[model samples]
Target: MRHLRSLLFVPGDRPERFAKAAASGADAIILDLEDSVVPARKADARKAVADWLASERDVPAIVRVNPLGSDQIDADIACLRRIAPDAIMLPKAEGAESIATLDSLLGDLDAPIIPIATETPAAIFELGSYRACADRLAGLSWGAEDLPAAIGAATSREEDGRYTAPYELVRSLTLFAAHAAAVPAIDTVFPAIRDESGLAAYVARAARDGFTAMLAIHPAQVAVINAGFTPGAGEIARAQAIIAAFADNPGAGALALDGKMIDRPHLIQAQHVLARAAASLLPSEGGAFSKAFNRSKPHTTSSR
Candidate 1:
């Protein structure tokens, strides 16, 4: 799949909102069958998700199946076998073993996997193992909510909504792990849905810290996430200028660019910026998020 800037989550049991989520201008939609769905409704949710995936979709559809070792995962896999989604999001993923196990269960079904890499304490220690199964991964993401509860912490964040010391460490580890695996690093969700300013700042920080995409709990955050990840006009121009400077100095190890010294590393960074700029344009060119900002109807569903 193309580099997704925003992946919105919709409850699997709430089939009524599936269409809305598809039209929410998000790069992809995640049909959540894990913590979002109650245990009693697991079967019903599975059936509902299967029915939806049976049809065609413009936006990429990813199903967040129940974690490994759970009874629900077997049924979830059975449902996926009937109609596979574009990708699968594995929750509470421990390591390469988890990805390998899920791949074996998938058999002939060939959807890419995006694992929530940090949920349990054991998962933290296993981050380095993801490089082993990197080929099977779409991206690597982490969860703050589940990890805090799993470790018996009072909260993952402070009063300002910033992640505490322990949570920050895990977040940084997840970022490095994703890079080590040679895949895109996806940032976790910002749960405070109504705080638009906070969401924007968080998105900017995620982009600054090298996260290519972010998880969205609500449809409203899609626009902000998309804008934050996309390179600005000035950024694109600067990147182009840097590339041109390198081109002018063919064999030079270091060159002056607007009075500052730039080397091969700067050239590489400039190339990456241009690549991101190109990827950002894909969504608006007959992609799912083309008309995202045009819709005026506000979504009211609260994210869990």
Candidate 2:
């Protein structure tokens, strides 16, 4: 919720990488206990994650716990109760019911929940339910990897590694759902860790599509993701121009700017952009380590 432009995942079984992931400049580190950890290493991963939470964490951390109804869910909840992380990331969350169940289990822990909202076919229909538990939610993200497998598809992507039509629909729905629920829509990870150009294009498209944040599978992707999502000079200038036009033409329903009609909707859009850009300038709170300073490009929130 704190302008999470990039969240990096570290395998829960690999405690050696925990500190490294924290130092990678990501806004938050997700200790993954599900897909990243093998079946046999689950218990060990849980122990390692618990131990890390028990100790001092220099970065904000989220635990990607095992899916609902898994044998490991109980243990995951137990560890969470012992030491609640900043938030809990739920995989394969079908609907509000799973979230409600987690709420009941956690009782008064008060940890925010971020569900992978498009992992299953059932999850596609459950997007609307997020609004009911919006207050307990931190952010909403969707994955293209698991959904294809769950639905028995050959692949979730095209040969170019772009999302296929069906998975694209899932992505769009997740975006709308997150906005509808009044939470940040975090784009899924670009799994091709080595393909920096592909990752850059993907993140750029995500930011253009109104995604407030993105997930990163590797440290190398964090800086690019953060830069892509952060409001750039051109964007801030456009927002300021739009706001100034509206301010000058008080009580006018619409105004002309650069030969284009700027209406109430455009004014609102500009204000939102400025607001998010302003938020990006705030210092990290609660020892949340970030490599945002790595950005070489200048970003100005000062409206002219």
Candidate 3:
């Protein structure tokens, strides 16, 4: 499934934010009805989200409903029926049971799934089985906040502002869960709104750890997230060189390229990088968008 490399989460209760989130340059927008919306405003948020989904728009809009056992599930389900989002973000997903329950509830509905893997105690142990019910599932992600609190952690971060070791374990587990399920491994949001550098560092860490995308809380975070996840010129060149150096080497099983090992796995990795670079190259928009006068950033594929 094609997904948003940068997904911006907008509070469903905020009508003004919902409208602007579409054009905020995120590949998708998550109209959040869970944590972002207060308990009293949930009904109002659901109504607003339902209305927004009916309207035609360029952005791939999704609704993040409350957890399965919540009192708001009925309202969330009703809102989903009306809105018909691209996918449903299931927060606090427990395991196969929870997914099976959702499937049973909405048996005939066609909406896809994107389950957040870290939420509660049960979620951590059941993560290995999370992808068992993946017929309609898109990917997996982890939350640093909920799981830590569920286990009675004081905070989710380290002194250097990185996720604590416990949180890192969850993140890796989420990545493996998606990979095992043959789906995208989405990274969680960077909460520091004003710390662009910190956000970039976090994105870089996630990308290096094999996450394909990230959640964004603000419009300002979108561009950096997109750029950070995308493979650049140096990456593409190195990938190409790796592929070239290994090709037609009949006598050698493993060869050295730039003093680094170039083997079967490395070749596979290189090709994957090139593939992502190719996929991200959208057709240059002109006319109404006016690409002629605007200076576009010279990208990885531009020279190619």
Candidate 4:
């Protein structure tokens, strides 16, 4: 609902790329201090990210800090205290307990969080616990890169780069968790930047499967991700027609459209499509549009 269709990742240590990433048309930019920065460069990366955030205004950025139990987390928290980012991306999120702990730790700062919820074997068992901290989340997302290593697997994908069985399950659970929490479900990174065809197909599949947004490792993939998630003119027109049909006949429970029977279920979907379209037309810097779909009430179909 926040139109986070494309969230690009930039290394925190690469200060020169910060401005470039801001201009890349990505809905949000994540300054990654965890996996992207080596242990020796952690301090420097934190300083660079803090300096950039201090100088820049109107940049929609989030910081990917070290995992909850890592030693570097203290330093990350200190850095965040000095320079408040728009949001925080928590890596290797275990469950509600960790989230609660973080909530206590951040006491006054209390920035919105987006957790990479499926990176460890233990994380697979705690997907349901996210609902407890749903109110503080910007959205929910998962990662395939860390899971394979955690599970001692050679790869998490097939020869074609599609997720294998285990990781596929993780992806689905992440989707349901986000929806259950009434937040957006952002898909994991595609990893292969040069394969434009592969990236496009993967992103289309993600959009069709109810993923609200996607994480991009490179700037080149942002355009493709944005296009894949944004509703096309034909889809917008069809959704509008369905809404109009239902509005025109207030007493009717169902109606015919394009020679097919339209019902309550279809109407509900059309409304969602239109809502997403409207949100897309607005800015994507986590402003007023961020809470457009963060409703606690279910978006159920109306008979009228």
Best by lDDT: 1
Output the lDDT of residue 237, model 2. 99
User: Which residue runs does candidate 4 get wrong by more than 4 Å?
Assistant: 286-304
> What Cα-based lDDT does every candidate model obtain?
0.85, 0.84, 0.78, 0.84
Candidate 4 local lDDT, 127-202, one digit each (tens): 8888877777788999998999987999989997878999899999999999988888999998888999999999
lDDT sort, best first: 1, 4, 2, 3
Those runs of model 2 whose alpha carbons end farther than 4 Å from true positions after fitting are 287-304
* Tens-digit lDDT string for candidate 1 (163-263): 99999999999999999988889999999999999999999999989899999999999999989988899988989998998788898889988899999
Question: Clashing residue pairs in candidate 2, if any?
Answer: none
Model 4 has a clash total of 0
Clash count for each candidate, listed in order shown = 0, 0, 0, 0
Q: List the residue pairs that clash in candidate 1.
A: none
The prediction achieving the highest TM-score against the true structure is: 4
Ranking 2 against 3 by lDDT, winner: 2
Question: Model 1 misses residue 90 by how many Å?
Answer: 0.4
Q: Against the correct fold, how does model 4 do in TM-score?
A: 0.92
Q: Compare candidates 1 and 4 on lDDT and give the better one.
A: 1
lDDT (tens digit, per residue) of candidate 3 on 148-243: 778899998988888788888888888998888777789998989999999999899888989999999999999999888889999999999988
What does candidate 2's lDDT look like per residue over 1-304, in tens digits? Answer: 2577888999999999998888887878999999999999999998999998888865688899999889889888888898778888999987677788777777667777789988888889889888777767778999988888887899988998888899889999999999998988999989888998999899989999989999999899999998898889999999999999888889999999999998999999899888888877765443332122121111211111
Which is better, 1 or 3, measured by lDDT? 1
Cα deviation of 182, candidate 2, in Å: 0.4
